[model samples]
Target: MNKYVLSLLCVSSMSFAATPFIYHDFDEAMQIRNYPKAFALTNRILNYDGKQFFELGRSLYNQYNPSVLPSRSEPIIPKHIHQIWIGGPLPEVFKKYIDTWKQMHPDWGYTLWTDENVRELFPLHNQSYYDESEGMGVKSDLLKWEIIYRFGGVYVDVDYECLQPLDELHHLYDFYTAYQPLDAFFVQLGAALYAAHPEHLILKHCIETIQDDWHHKGAPKKSGPCHFSKSFMAVAGENGSRDIAFPSFYFYPLGSKERVLRRSQWVREGAYAIHHWAMSWMPINTRRQEFRTFENERSSKVWND
Candidate 1:
């Protein structure tokens, strides 16, 4: 069943109804550095079943740090978000975005899934980071997609700023993604998207099918769909409910020929989210022509609003 289809009212009732299952993993604990909280939350979730194995793992974790418990109340939100997972390491900067989100939508609530505690409950055979770009015979990016298939809710890059209510995206489609193609032209990345939607098969397939070739070819020479996560949409096209692609201005600004081309499209289309894949805390290029799109849009009524 499409969980979100349950009308906002019904979703609210079941948002935190089911306790998440857990597994045991030592590496995850070290990486996330939050073993105590993870173990404590697990015990609370599995307290009713009295499962022997889970009990043992919970005991081990608790022995190390006795003060952990399931978040009595997940930060409240308007609807139920099945499972929200963040793939990378949790850094301090990311917390600012979370705070921004909370400030923007006080009622919105969602749980965060991290590798840190997941392995403790459900152990996986392979858990390490690898980076390979195009034709390098590397499947590193696949990590993000794997999580998307199993979870739902919004998946955003740590660098992205929460500018508006996520609820607004509910009507657009089952998925949403940034669009950045290389060409010194324009394209979006897949850092932000709605996952756990059945339609996401399109994105999953696109990544598996196109990533190697796109990376090998590099930017400027790459085709539109070949760009990877940026254009990857929910396979379920427009079915009364469909995935929509927002403009770059929402995330990335026009700062160069590449920026201009990419941001121009979104400028004309007027996007809801701006991707900062190429531009993080610093500017991409100094050419005023390039920054024009992002700069002008940054001060516009749309940006201020």
Candidate 2:
């Protein structure tokens, strides 16, 4: 009994003759544009008996998407930004990007979680996992979900440069994701920048699965994009319906060769952020040619002090 599939109108009045009367009432409600009543009638299909949603539904992994229902009334994700710096000092270029986020949204709350603070802020078990993770990327990925889930705000990678203020997005969605430029089967969600309300099911599934399903050797496959992408779509409806996503073209203009071999003029114009592709975790042999360290002069865009 997939309650979500129940027709838009199926409320019962306990009589065969009640069908026509119900339709008449429904028509009147629609004519009056009473969306609240229409929604209530639809929710009746679930016959909710006050059981916790976790116990009632088989899995929220298939709930309204991009990953969760849009926040049309009041935003669920707070107007805060969370970033991680679990290692040493940030590079000058990275710091510049962080400042841009503040310049763009000075009133929004900002949190920079460092190694010392994360241990105090996060649970002991999480500290163990963070301590054991191989690289900065892995450690950051682990905290990205937990911190955002615990605090309900936008978690952004320190390397991501903000081109625009993210305040407007808060008005429309409880969960939002950034996508890679391309995918073989489904939308490839980038972990670099995303917003969510605390205890969001998608984030919950990610946190729970990372511990059990973590067999991969790399961060992307372990807890980064590859892992998060599968969890994201599995919990979302087909093709990420009802969910909000900013495509790669709008986030990572110079995507890796695998995706947007090169960015088009239009793509650059539309981009709201830039991921400077600082692949510090890659081995010397594995690192891509273009991921220069911040020392080499940057080909800057939308950069602010």
> CA lDDT, every prediction?
0.35, 0.56
Best by TM-score: 2
Report the C-alpha lDDT of model 2 over 178-258, residue by residue, as the tens digit.
Answer: 555432222346788888878777887788888754666667667787677656655743333334445445565555434
For model 1, how does the per-residue alpha-carbon lDDT over 205-225 read when each residue is reduced to its tens digit? Answer: 644554344433322223222
Residue 90, model 1, lDDT: 50
C-alpha TM-scores of all predictions: 0.43, 0.64
Which window of 10 residues has the lowest lDDT sum in candidate 2?
14-23
**Candidate with the greatest lDDT versus the true structure:** 2
- For each candidate, C-alpha RMSD in Å? 21.5, 17.6
Model 2 clash pairs are 61-235, 65-241, 65-242, 65-243, 66-242, 66-243
